[model samples]
Target chain A: MQYLFFLLAAISVITALVVVAAKSPINSVIALVLCFLSIAGHYILLNAQFLAMVHVIVYTGAILVLMLFVIMLLNMNTIVEVRKPVITRILAVVTGGLLFLVLLAATKQGLSVDVPTGFDPGVGLVKRIGMSLFQDFLLPFEVSSVLFLSAMVGAMMLAKKDGTENVNLPPSSEPDLRQAGPNDSAA
Target chain B: MENVMTAIRVVPLEHYLILSFLLFSIGMVGALVRRNIIIVIMCLELMLNSVNLLLVAFSAYHSDPGGQVMVFFIMLVAAAEVTVGLSILVLMKRNTDGVDMNILNRLKW
Candidate 1:
């Protein structure tokens, strides 16, 4: 069990790295999908079966497809992408490394707290999660639906053609591409 | 099933924390360093997933349903965030004719 856990962790970490470092957006998205799958495996190992399934379905099924559609729609390519200053890239790495080190140190301290060693196997079950969602977290759960609705309307409004209110924002000076059409220099 | 539970317990929770920290940092670096807006968004998703993993681990170890419940909420919010964010990205791409993050500097003076 320990070995399997390590293996899954390794897969997840390496795939996450690939997601970060891959030059192509498509490649990064693919790596992210793999990373999410390995994470689902981790969830299963952790006995959060319902969460694992939801993670797989929501991430791999809904999110990945949405990303692919956007990628295809936008027609992103690295050919035109200008590299950032070396100093900025270096700063980014340093910042990330420092964050990792600090968090690792915190984890070392966190380990000092005695967490209950055994798990209640039933907590991860779908029935348990559903009951909690409806009973204890019912308000937040319902609120999230409102959040979703608002997000949908907002996206639609933002993406609409001739939407001048948001167009007043910077970069509105650029030609509205909807008039030029979708395939206009889509590289 | 019983054997799997024992196996999970054998591994310290701190290991999970360290792994998630690494993943989150990588995603942060990617978000900071990458020029493509799409990739940046993907990195954001990666970071969110790392947190979800940590939450699930803690949820299992503590035998608490709340952590997983939180994960579910996070996923829900994440989905909404992605929808709104990608729409904005699409808008950016449409207006700018490219997805490069640098092009967004028009927001500056």
Candidate 2:
């Protein structure tokens, strides 16, 4: 069990580093998918089977694929990213290191807090989580549906062709008015 | 099921905390240093995942369903955020012909 935890931790850390360090966006995306998979493994190890499955589906399955599609659509797979200045990159690393140090120090003091509630292995099951979601968190669950709807609308508006460009043009112009026709009706 | 509990019990919770923190810092560094907007966005997702991992760890350790429920909400927000963010990325690419963050300096006064 300890070895499995170490293995998953190592995989997650390495893949996370690769996600940051890989030159190509595609490679980074692939590495990130691997990293998320490792995290799911960690979740399973931690006894959160439902969360583990959800993490795999929502993160590696959905979000990363969405990112990959966008990368491919933009043809960013071939374009090499320009490196930041060496000083800037070094400073970034230093800043992150400092943040990590601070976090470590903050957590170091509380390394062994007694668990207030006894461990329930079944707490992570889908049935338990579903009840919690539908009962205690019902309001947030409903509100999140609203959030999703708004996000869908917002994404469509933002990605629609000539959406922002039309907004910038004068409302009186003939071509602009014609172009805005479809958008207005759609809206 | 019994074996799963014993398996996780072998590892201390602090290790999970350290692992998630490391992942978060790596994401932060990537976001800071990367020039490509998409990669930066990916880094942001990485950070989010690290937090989710921590929350799940705590949830499991404390036997609290609330934490896992919170993770669900976080995922929901994250999904919505990514959709909007990527659409904006597509828009930026369409307008500028490149994904370089430096090109966004036009917004700076």
The chain A TM-scores for the candidates, taken one by one, are: 0.83, 0.84
- Write out fnat for all predictions, comma-separated: 0.83, 0.87
Candidate 1 lDDT, tens digit per residue, A136-185? 99999999999999999999988887745455356744567564666676
Full-model lDDT, candidate 2: 0.90
Error (Å) of candidate 1 at residue A2 is 1.0
Per residue, candidate 1 scores C-alpha lDDT tens digits across B1-109 of 7776764568888888889999999999999998888889999998999899888888887888999999999999999999999998988877767787887787897
TM-score, model 1, chain B versus true chain B: 0.93
CAPRI class of candidate 2 = medium
Top of the candidates by DockQ: 2
